[model samples]
Target: MKAKVLVTLKTGVLDPQGKAVQHALSSLGFAGVDDVRQGKLIELDLAETDPAKARDSVEAMCRALLANTVIENYSIDLVD
Candidate 1:
């Protein structure tokens, strides 16, 4: 099984890195972009065959280490 975890800052949280990227884009003449946010993509290859189990494991991973639950939100995508 394969799992993809997308971790992003929660809405309303200040994102300095995102702001920096936005500033850079505007400086580069990309004025159409009103905002920029950055996140991380984590791809995991798992030995578990059961979709349910794999999802459970990934969810645990997210809660334990993959994401900062207080300030970040995460979504999971599973593939065969």
Candidate 2:
């Protein structure tokens, strides 16, 4: 099984890295680019076969290590 995790900062939190990227884009002649937010993608390979179980395990992974629940939110997807 394959699992994908997307980790992103909470909406109200300040994102300095994202702001830097936004500024760089505009400087490079990418006009009309209003907002930019940066996030992380993590892909995991698992031996578990059941989608339900795989999702549960990955969710646990996120809570334990993959994501910082205080300032970040995570979304998970499972694929065969």
Candidate 3:
């Protein structure tokens, strides 16, 4: 099984890196980009075959290590 985890900051959290990127874009003349938010994508290959089990396992990974739940949120996508 293959899985993908997307980790991103909560809406109210401040994102310095995102700000920098936005500024850089404006400097480069990419206009009309009002806001930018940065995030991470994690890809994993697992031996588990069941979709339900894989999703549960990946969700556990997110809670335990993949994300900072206090300031970040994560979503899981499973591909067989």
Candidate 4:
């Protein structure tokens, strides 16, 4: 099985790095770039074949290490 995890900051959280990138893009003449939010995508290859089990494992991985749930949220997509 394969899984893709997307981790992103929650809304209303200040994202300084994203803001900096937004500013840089505007300065480079990329007009209408209103806002930017940074996030992480993690791809995992697993040995399990059960979709439910794989999803549980991936969710655990995200909660245990991949994301800081205090300021971030994560979603997992499983693929064969």
Candidate 5:
């Protein structure tokens, strides 16, 4: 099984890196972009075969180590 985790900052959290990227985009003339929020995608291979079980396990991984729950939120996708 494969698990994909997307981790992103909460709406009210400060994102200095995202801000820098936004500024750089504007400077590069991508003015249509009004805002930018940066996030990460993590892919993991697992021994579990069930999609539900894989998702559950990856969610726990996010809560325990992949993400700081207080500042970030994560979603898990399972691919077979």
Candidate 6:
């Protein structure tokens, strides 16, 4: 089984890195770049095949170490 985890900062959180990137893009002559936000994607290869079990484990992983729930939200997707 394969799992994809997308972790991103929640709305209303200040994203300095994103802001810096946006500024850099604009300075590079990239027009109309209104905003930029950065996030993390984690891909995991698992031995389990059951979707339900994989989801459970992935969620656990997110809560435990993959994501910082304080300022971030994460979604998990399971694939063959």
Q: Write the per-residue lDDT of candidate 4 for residues 1-80, one digit (tens) a residue.
A: 99999999999999999999999999999999889999999999999999999999998999999999999999999998
**Residue pairs of candidate 2 with colliding backbone atoms:** none
- TM-scores of all predicted structures: 0.97, 0.96, 0.97, 0.96, 0.92, 0.97
lDDT of 6 by residue, 1-80 (tens): 99999999999999999999999999999999999999999999999999999999999999999999999999998888
The residue pairs found clashing in candidate 4 are none
For model 3, give the 10-residue run with minimal summed lDDT.
71-80
Model 2 misplaced stretches (Cα beyond 4 Å): none
What TM-score should be assigned to candidate 6? 0.97
Q: Candidate 3, which segments miss by more than 4 Å at Cα?
A: none
> How many residue pairs in model 5 have overlapping backbones?
0
List model 3 lDDT by residue over 1-80, tens digit each: 99999999999999999999999999999999999999999999999999999999999999999999999999999987
- lDDT score at residue 5, model 2, on the 0-100 scale: 95
Candidate 4 vs. true structure, TM-score: 0.96
Candidate 1 lowest-lDDT run of ten = 28-37
Model 5 agreement with the true structure over 13-35: per-residue lDDT tens digits: 99899999999999998888878
lDDT of 5: 0.90
Candidate 1's residue-wise lDDT over 1-80, tens digit each? 99999999999999999999999999989879888889999999999999999999999999999999999999999988
